[model samples]
Target: MTIQTVTTTPYNDQKPGTSGLRKSVKHFKKPDYLQTFVQAIFNTVQGIEGSTLILGGDGRYFNREAIQIILRMAAAAGFGRVILGQSGILSTPAASHLIRQYQAIGGIILSASHNAGGPEGDFGIKFNISNGGPAPEQLTEAIYEASKGIHSYQIAPIQPIPLDKLGTYELHGMPIEIIDSVTDYMALMESLFDFDKIAALLQADHFKMRFDAMHAVTGPYAHRILEERLGAPKGTVMHGQPLANFGGGHPDPNQAHAKELMALLFARKSEFDFGAASDGDGDRNMILGKQFFVTPSDSLAVLAANATLIPGYRNGIAGIARSMPTSQAPDRVAIKLGLPYFETPTGWKFFGNLLDAGRITLCGEESFGTSSSHVREKDGLWAVLFWLNLLAEKQDSVENIVRKHWAEYGRNYYSRHDYEEIDLKAANELIAALLDKLPSLTGQTFGALTVGSADNFAYTDPVDGSVSQNQGIRILFTDGSRIIFRLSGTGTQGATLRVYLEKYEADTNKHDQDVQEALADLLTIAEQVAQIQAFTGREAADVIT
Candidate 1:
């Protein structure tokens, strides 16, 4: 294979966010903007002159066009082969699965995960490492440096390779393999879960359920699993289509964006016993009951407690982890099991090193992501299936099971309120101000609240001893109540400030109340401590998860 190079100038917005380089479509459409970054990825990585590359995207706006450009560029960059999904549509987890299954060098995932998509919306390109995890910090930094002074991007003058057929073809004498998008992924899921039991549970009508795909990438996977594979009726899956615009929906599976489905469950209250949804690229997830919401913290705890019920996890869990901002529910479980409990930085990438080194088996974040050793990246549909399998084994309703778990282990009341798209500079100022006051806040008493400690979080990766500073600011109270504040890294526009409140009550009498109402007093203290209202100029949060 012969390689070619084309000279070009650097584009300014190549800095990757928490996930990857995400920005408005217009930002990516600049002359040589996408090409410059893609070339930087190839040049910075090793052994790509004649190696296999996997390519696909979330089927968002500009996805197909970007795939075409990338294909030509991959050929020109001297890749020996490219494994692409049909129509270049692969959910994030599926792409990760493909890379691991085929042992490809790495893959380019075209997605601005959970961000809106359309001609006028957003687009993103992320490179997954050979292990199917997001590129580690070093690689991302190298790519960023390369983007700063990129002088050339290589692409061959060739017709667009057809992606609809599942067969092998040759481009510039390089092999290109188009694989069935669902086959390998489905097989993997079947191996990990008990499909027979899940099907039996569906047939028994043990519990009515609804899955909303949010008009994004998970629509097909949801439909195939719930309707075709598990024998759910066709309409049980909602918004089952892949639209560039996400059918005018936000495509985020949080309470704010999925209010419609939430309202339906609350109103009917009879047809649905379980409710779940997946985000745009199929990584984030939200799970609920008819009138009961499963806080992400509680969900992770329950999954960790019952992980042995699943076929793949029947040997007992290896370890558990949660992002620093997430509540300490899993910590309680970890203590019980004598397992290693880890607290990492917010992004899912942090868990990859742990999983790769066998230091942990399961990890989750407050951002509605959960996964295990099954895959490096968070798996949304996988979480749903896990809950389903648990339901089958327990033969109990969602609320009942959660209530029982709380009764046994006590409750960790938790809530996260998000102030979206605030001025970035002002938000940073607010955080800095809070960090400066940490010393004053520590060991102080105000009313019934006595501050136990306060500090800015710094993480030292146990395996490598690498340090990550400024992960977030945290305040702990003598009463076991805590609050954390940070700027969200996944937002596409202005900064998003997230405040997480947590309190543990060992008393069963007060366990069943609503989370926000339970944490009302702590919320007041949090606002006062951080001066959140004055800083953001908003009295209330945009969304609470």
Candidate 2:
């Protein structure tokens, strides 16, 4: 096969966020758009020539085509070998494990995360480094720089390799190996969790749990682990097929998107003892109980407080880390356990250094993302399994366990309000105005809350000594209530302004109030301070979680 160097023009809009470059499928289908970006990654990653690469996607509409293109490009780029998941199916966490297990130079993950997927929907490409984590800011910046100046992309002149079967094939001098996507990941999970114990719990006549895959990538993983290996009933995993358009529904596993699952779990007489759901790429999760919801922040806290019950963490953890937007519940756990804690800006990449340096054993974000030193990327099924282990050991209802945790650690009432697809200019202006007002907000009182501090958040990574500034705006009150404003980068459309509200309550009697009702005053304070309605022209947030 001849190696073809096709000349191409660079696109300046390929700048990646913390998640990687995401755009509409139409934009990616443009001539040379995907090629330019892929070549830029190949050029930016040093020593890629004659090195290995792992490749796969979430089985979205464009997943297979993207895999074919990347495969040919890898062969032409002189890669020694390429490992692919069968039928181009791999969850974000699975891809991360493949990268680390093979010690490949890097892996390319094709997913829009929780976003919708279709011919007209969004598509994305994320490059994970040798550490099995998102590329750090420095490396992503280099890729962006290279993309801006790319002139050509290399590809082998060959037919598309069959990805349906598990086998080895040759492309030019590169060997392409297609492997079962779930086997290794299942083995890793089995190693971390007590499968036998969890199986017993799953098979118990009195206990029933449901795992909704949201018709995305986790269907196979959940089916294999929860149903096949653990002996749960056949229909225990809902939406258990990976659909190209995610069944024409948003794959986000929040209260809004996973409405069916939420309704079933929150029913007046719910049948299930435990409930969980995972997002598009299977990196994010939503945990629910009979007539109860466990906030991602509280879930992290509960897991950490009872982590030793699980075999993987039986020896105990080294430390804890959470995104700045995540509530301080886990921080309380870190304190009670005397383990060190660190808070960084949003993005899994920020936790990579900590996990690799043995500084943190568990890390998570408020946006339904959580994991540990087990895998660099967040693993949704893993989070579900962790909860299962806790359930089996504690032999308590999910609500009771959470309530006890709250009674011990004090409940941190937390919610995230997302105003998605707002005008880009308006969102930028709102943040600018917020920044201008930060200096004057401190010591001011809105309602019964007095501002303790107000500033744009910044962080310095202790492991690598790198600084990231302008992360978000934080308005912390003297009463331990907080309102945070940050523009989300994961969306492909117009900007998404995310407002985070948190309040700490030490009284167990006060924990039963509705989340929104508990923070009604703070919500008013947020609108008053940020002027969200006037700025974004939205009377209420589009989604609240």
- For all candidates in order, the CA lDDT equals 0.87, 0.94
What are the models' TM-scores? 0.97, 0.99
Q: What lDDT tens digits, residue by residue, belong to model 2 across residues 133-197?
A: 99999999999999999988999986789999999999887999999999999999999999999
TM match of model 2 to true structure: 0.99
Model 1 worst lDDT window (10 residues) = 263-272
Off by over 4 Å in 2: none
lDDT of candidate 1 over 149-226, digit per residue (tens) = 888888877667888788988877778898877778888899989999888887774567788999999988888888
TM-score of 1: 0.97
Error of 1 at 198 (Å): 0.4
